[model samples]
Target: MFQNPSNEAIASILKNAKTIAVVGLSDDPSRESYAVSAEMQRRGYKIIPVNPNVQEVLGERAVASLADLPEPVDIVNIFRRSEALPDVVREAVNTSAPVIWAQQGIYNEEAADIARAHGKTMVMDRCIMVMHSLFVRGA
Candidate 1:
């Protein structure tokens, strides 16, 4: 079961993060991943697209996997299904990222355990764009 994430923690992650590795980020403008990432980019966050199927997204080079990122990302924003999160979390544990966020309607306790064990701030079942609008600014 997933407990609610702390507002302060979510706020801290959003407030401090700059480069975000959007795993499963879609190039389609209609997708939530695209909309969320676009808004974040518009807010000045460097959006790193981590989709293997696409060469690039939103003008940024898309990496195939978390290990392919050229540098460490401040946040790993995943749009994959809850069942797929364990694999992504396993990959993310190898990185030095400070935060790992699963978009709304996605959460896996086991995966969250892995992230928490690795000292990452796990924010699940919450929309980053909504949180940013409500907590960070322009609410």
Candidate 2:
């Protein structure tokens, strides 16, 4: 099993992260991923939506995959099931993103291992918005 990141580490990641590639982000606002990524954008972080099916999200052009991102990224925020993380990790490694964040209720030790192997910070089963609120915005 993968342990969640420490509060301090999460706070640091949220503090420094400026570009977040949100994988599996849906167009529907009802989805947790959409809501969280949108909030991140509201905080001035650039949100790159990574969903093959979506052309755009939050007024930004969406990339089909992490590998398709035009610029280097600070964080790869994953919203898929645990079963999908391994592939996402592989793709994220290609970008050399500093952090791999699996949203609340999602965890994959295999993907975490892959991220750690590449020296990327791995956070599982935590909501980025919640962490940012508690740490940066101090809600």
Candidate 3:
């Protein structure tokens, strides 16, 4: 379920991924998580907002954590601080998401290593929306 995506593989993931669970999602439209999730939703991907404080986002019910998601998630996009990486990685492992995407400016070598060790597709310090536009969506 998990494998490192080469440029071509990344292209494939973007082409086929149907759902994304966005951790650290915020109600504030200005937040990076919200913006990216909104973009992805507009692009036709289901964006599940994972956050404790928010009850809803983008008209969808918000999940408090990844583990609480009722269905399989193809990708887990994280917007948390780097210091929180380990716990997030553990959750990603538990959730069995095929891809774990650490948003732009968010990176932790230890977490990336753990994710890779678990055979997860890990994309650190990158923006999925940007990558999708550049490599697949042709924005």
Report the C-alpha lDDT of model 2 over 24-119, residue by residue, as the tens digit. Answer: 999999989899998999999999999999999999899998879988889999999999889999888889588999998888889999988888
Clashing pairs in 1: none
What is the Cα-based TM-score of model 2? 0.95
lDDT head-to-head 2 vs 3, winner: 2
| Number of backbone clashes in candidate 1 | 0
For all predicted structures, in order, the TM-scores are 0.95, 0.95, 0.93
Q: Taking the tens digit of each residue's C-alpha lDDT, what string does model 3 give over 11-56?
A: 8888889989999999999888888899999999998899999999
Of the pair 1 and 3, which is ahead by lDDT? 1
Task: Put down candidate 1 lDDT per residue, 1-139, tens digits, no spaces.
Answer: 5565688777778898889999999999999999999999999999999999999899999999999998879989999999999899999888778888899999999999998888777888999899999889953
Candidate-wise lDDT, in order: 0.90, 0.89, 0.87
- Which parts of model 3 have CA positions greater than 4 angstroms off? 1-4
Off by over 4 Å in 1: none
Residue 82's lDDT within candidate 1 is 96
